[model samples]
Target: MDDGTRLGQADHAAGPRPPGVIFTMRYPSDVGFVWKTIALHRDLIARAFGGEARCILAYPQLSPTSAYQPRWSTAIQADFYDYSAENRQRLERVITDEAIRLVVFMSAQPADVDLGFLRGLGLRTVTSENNSYDHSLRQPFMKRLAKALIRRVLKRQVFDLHIANSQAQYDFLRGFAQLPASRLRAVRNGVDTDHFQPGERTGACSTLGLDPDRLWIMAASQARPEKRLERVLEVIRAVKDARPALPIGFFFVGEGENLAEWRQIALGLPDAETYRFFGRQNDLRPYYQAASVFIHGAFRESFGLVIAEAMASGLPVVATHAHGPAEIIAEGETGRLVGRDDWEGLGKAVIEYLDDAELRRTHGLAGRARCVALFSITRQAQEFADLLRPFLKDGAGAPY
Candidate 1:
């Protein structure tokens, strides 16, 4: 991995433009949320720094699911297969070559990489933790202890700034990681309200081959153990048991390893014939528009991005009282929040929305107003700029 040359060699050969920001995430999946965050905020970050700001992106691999071609800035593929001295030296080339002023490490996994080296190069540093309730935080004593120790060790390297996706995440960093409050900032994840807003329901369900007239409930999340999608199936079954005569359908979007298991569970339930699985999708607006209610069964999240999107789309949401959702959902207003493990409560909430059309409309309208007022991408971008203002002076760097 070594080119056998010092960092200065690459810097000497670089262009005359001011060193811009470089965001490092080992894997940059095209359809993944992190990539979407970069895409949404890149231009705004650049504008905040300077009109001529150039943002460079570095990642280990492109996701196979989405064809992610970078249109806004330069992309560097820095393979992190081996975190050896040679690889570290080679990775530094991307930084030196681009003359990056500030380096934002997007994931907590790689934040410890080249710490002293980055400091020596006078590169401003920032790190972000996106998971509010990490699954390991719920593991058994020995495993949890081991993870805590590992996390503590990995985060020994301090940053100029720390970004938390939600207040819960911000609290986790301060409490568990002992990150200073001065360095921590909680910026809730925002949605593209315009793209995900309410629309005509005429073809919304039919386009997915679903009966538009029947009541449809939608849940979108990666089908994973921690997400508790199985509980969603249980909620569906419980709802059916409680309301036998109600004609209802369930629609699930997004895909993961647990998707097959969820599908199998969905197949065996009563009225299971109405279960619709629209695997990983690039467009989710139609699903949100067609649904009578939006349901989220995840036990935890860094920030409930999908919940905000659903609200923006004017759908009444029923989600578990997970870390992010507990903070996001306005109970009995925009949506309802049940205990994370309460399947019956989840079912009851769903049924309430199903039985009453007036309830759905009232909650949906309120949710939309709340989402638009509080969680727009433009608002988040500005918050980022405010947080990053101090660092972007004369020759300071950009945040990711």
Candidate 2:
């Protein structure tokens, strides 16, 4: 790795320079978690390499001069879908100009990007798998066929490496996709512990117009059918019915195709007044900090980023025993994990935390500690640096 002084120095005038890296994804809205995660990874990678390794963001829809600049040193507008000769030449120009050696697809799929074209540039490429393939196959016919086709095409693509966000995904790629083990890696998603730490609820409550006296249970994720948010609503209703006088509220953040439907369902519940749906929040720290406990109802999450974020925010997690949550939550120490769709068990766990303030405090602190030790963004950066180091070329100021 380059020292601080060397990092600040200009590139050498002679010989081919050490290559940099570009993380590519669909330039979707800034409100979602995918973009935020990619930005954090880029920032940490640059920091890990002592600012020697240049990190850039490339997206199909992002404008070169967009008003909303991404949080990176450099960004380029390169369309992956437009496979015209002109687009290819433009992308080649970007690779040469930026000395890009590695292309890591953070959110874009093989179908979205031309993997063969990227490999032909003599660049090492990586694809990060963030979804559960098994669960995807369980979708309706058309959706399942689309997912299967993507998986088939992904298997045929000649990429340098494949990263799975969770161990279950790694297994799927290894067994179901039949990818070589040498080219596969399981890197669990991480959270920025510094940004999502324990904080006083007063400011968050005041800002969101939440009652400070009422205990809140929070769930922050896209309201997709696979998320099983209806299960969470059922639990909330059950809890309220059991404890009619308990001053408890449910704070739901994020919007999706099913968000409006879920909102309507929540309104039908007897404790409808206790539920608040703040759709698609740009910042989720306040909601996490203000909540007493965090619940996730996803039936099969490859890697529950929200669960890690909730743990980092010093909120005890009551999540389904899905792949990611099973790995993140330390059963008795940090939080509780019930079987998927086990509304009764989930409610019981929520009640356990709500009824005892001391238990909540102990578990919340433990969860935060676990996040710092195992799931911090800094740790993730180090892991990625180790993986990418061997592939980086040797040159002056290179992170090798």
Candidate maximizing TM-score: 2
What do the candidate models score in CA lDDT, each in turn? 0.73, 0.75
lDDT of 1 by residue, 1-23 (tens): 13322233453455466656776
Task: Give me the displacement of residue 150 in model 1, in angstroms.
Answer: 13
Q: lDDT, candidate 1, residue 382?
A: 76
What's the count of clashing pairs in each model shown?
A: 0, 0
lDDT of 2 by residue, 1-400 (tens): 0311112224436565556887765554243454566566766776676655677666565533343344435555565556788888877877777677888776445567787887787777777777654444433667545544544444454357788887888877766565656678888778888888888987788888999888999998877888888878988888877777789999899888999989999998876887999987656788898999999988788888888888999999998888788889999899999988688999999999989999999999999999888888777877877777666655422122
By summed lDDT, the worst window of 10 consecutive residues in model 2 runs over: 1-10
Listed per candidate, the RMSD to the true structure in angstroms reads: 5.0, 5.9
Question: How well does candidate 1 score on lDDT at residue 228?
Answer: 84
With candidate 2 superimposed using the best TM-score fit, by how many Å does residue 64's alpha carbon deviate from the native? 10
Candidate with top lDDT is 2
